[model samples]
Target: MKRILTTFALCSAMIAGSASLPLHAADAVSNTSAEKVLPLNQRMAKKSPEWLSRGIMYQINPRAYTPEGTLKAAEAKLKDLADLGMTIVYLCPVFVADDDMNREFWSPRQKKSQMDSPLNPYRMKDFYHVDPEYGTDADLKSYVDTAHKLGLRVMLDMVYLHCGPTAVLIDKNPNFVKRNKDGKIITGPWKYPLLNFESPELREYLFQNMEQWVRDYGVDGFRMDVADGVPLDFWEAARVRLEKLNPEIGLLAEGTRKENQLKAFDLSYGWPFSGPVRKVFVGGASAKSIRDSKEGFRKARPIGGDRIIHFIDNHDISNDDYENRTEERYGEKGVNAALAMMFTLDGTPMLYCGQEICDKNRHSIFGSKFGCTINWANAGSEEAKRRQELLRSLIETRNSRPELTFGELIWLDNSAESDVVTYLRKLDGKQTLVLVNCRAKPVSVDVTLPDGVKRHFDLKDYEFVIE
Candidate 1:
């Protein structure tokens, strides 16, 4: 929920100015520079094919996915997902929860209409077994197989920072938990108990159990939750073991920090970009500030490293929106523009489960969370269909264009009155200029291009090439 990066060092000059604040770059060069060229072979060697390089990830909330809310039913929609052009599918949690049993176990309100059974699936009841409500272990395998059949890789949400006090593992293996100064084991967050990664037995058990998920289910990787809470040593060890199992497997960290970027993870959340991007779109934050912050992160990356995962909405954002935001803030057009920003820029972009259909309802699942279902009836609506179609086109374009997939990025400077952000990505001998107008008024500005060849990419119709 919180950001992990605190360092404020200027690392690169490729960051352009936006509305947030004017970022000055003394040595900034034009988009057509020799250093701005990336080779496809080199990028493949450095980034690997399994890291969702140029791929799109779609987030699925199992509980809220359907009225039935079972793995079987969820799996039935794999075709619908793949049809949307999502290559990577990420499900929140599959393991049974300690709290999902009673019909009203999770909902505090107790109102039948507002209440769904209690199930914080992420709070593990048993790492080795799947929750019956969600489905059986074999069902999980089926889901994985089905996803692979559709050409989609699955990333399970790993919540290892802590577990429910009543977790079966707690009673079966007391050593799996963190201990206080008294040498007594603690359990649950309410009890301030956490997994003691320092203990040899605990460490071995956690690592093996996690590795088992990959081995048994044929899962691609883990989207580690609260990754910052865990130490680097644990991650380094897990990375080593997991890599041994499948080197091409992907690892996504929820926490994004410079210290965690030491090759242990394939990609991490792009908070540095997400935070500023949200502010700029809502008019609370300036595009200039967002660009400067992103520049700071890019400056820190080594020559060849894992790309960052960029997005405007996720479980975190949706949950937070329940508290202080509204669907109006991210209306249909606004959300689409945000998607365009994520897709055109560097790194893999994530689409939250119901984003395509425009689920405006903001409710948390922590309590009697609405368990808001995707409006399937609206699936055929013009707005929903259009968004999905646009997403498909962008994804297809990204997959086809080597330059967009692994190209070097150079942000172009527009005038102070400009509300549009322009940048270029280049690889091989090909190059593309992406200009996104974030304003209501029509923008008329001269954009410099490589070899003085300016091409305009219209976000409205998904068009490119300068006039």
Candidate 2:
């Protein structure tokens, strides 16, 4: 229980800067973080690059983003994403996808086999090679280089838990995979075989490959899928090794386990917290529920909560099903309300591709039998243009003002209505009053502000107002 740069501390160092003591420095207190929470600035006088705290990441599936569905094609949109206030561009799996397992899946025209399901990007065929469909290794380098030029960091999608049914490891080193009682390889729900992390050789293999992505492609971060499935010891050991190679590179875990944030990962998705935010708009949820949820999450954090990745829709959640789409599930206004909550909360925000334009289609990177690519033409349409501007404004509010990203919440009285939630984000002498009406219909409630503070109160259905 001595001073140590645990994963939590590393994440804080990337956000709160040198002012933050190493996470384990509080040896006298419980490791669960018994210390009293302080205001954003007071908690740490220094701050990391503004991008880490105010970061807004836009996720793109290279194979589903542009009609060409290649890294080169997606590179053309980097500047646009940057303009949208995205400091990080996360590409969903650029490595070679398992073609052997997808022989039955057809290509765009029903002319050839696509060889894989969009739901299974984790089934990698090669740890080092870029997918033929996603262009050559040079294309990935160019993509990362373009993002860097735009002042953007590139986060690669990594899947270490498993490989494709026909991965080379399955043949060359079958011992690296898990075997069932029947001596058959154990597979996940998607039929993808699982890797055996107990094997030191396998761990080294994955570690070296992840290192290659950072060193070779200059990737700034890695979004590991199903991180909890891997042994915590391995993640911790690998993190120590990887960070020594490049201290600035970051690691993001797709899992929700809070303990994962305490040690091995720099960031983890706030999957549990996201449910309450989305439910608040779906009706039946009260303002108290949202307040309680946010407060609890803030208090429960073992380190800087800013490391949490908040998002309304992601590649995995933004499925092809209508019920899962941002437009159909939450609608434009609901999506905006969610954004208001997500950005104003203590976390790094993320925007899925087409989310800025209120894109209706869910991302289906690879066709099971037919093609379903994003229509690039939407970026030019009138509705898309409006949404783009709206999205830009929402993110700018978070990035331009330190209070929004680092502020402590001062919940305001909203007893007048259950459908409405109001609060103030105050820090560094700046304050932003956020009022959100979670109902499907407009609510006109008379609101009283603190002395010398002023804001508009009239709210439309599912409208989020920041003043």
The 0-to-1 C-alpha lDDT of every candidate, in the order given, reads 0.63, 0.65
Worst 10 residues of 2 by lDDT: 6-15
Mind giving the per-residue lDDT tens digits that candidate 1 earns over 27-50?
Answer: 122223343364321222123344
Steric overlap count per candidate: 13, 1
lDDT of 2 by residue, 408-467 (tens): 556665443466666666776777766667667766655545553434455666766667
Which is the leading candidate under lDDT? 2
Off by over 4 Å in 2: 1-50, 102-119, 296-300, 320-324, 368-371, 445-456
Model 2 lDDT vs. the true structure? Answer: 0.65
**TM-scores for every candidate against the unseen true structure:** 0.81, 0.81
Candidate 1 accuracy as TM-score: 0.81
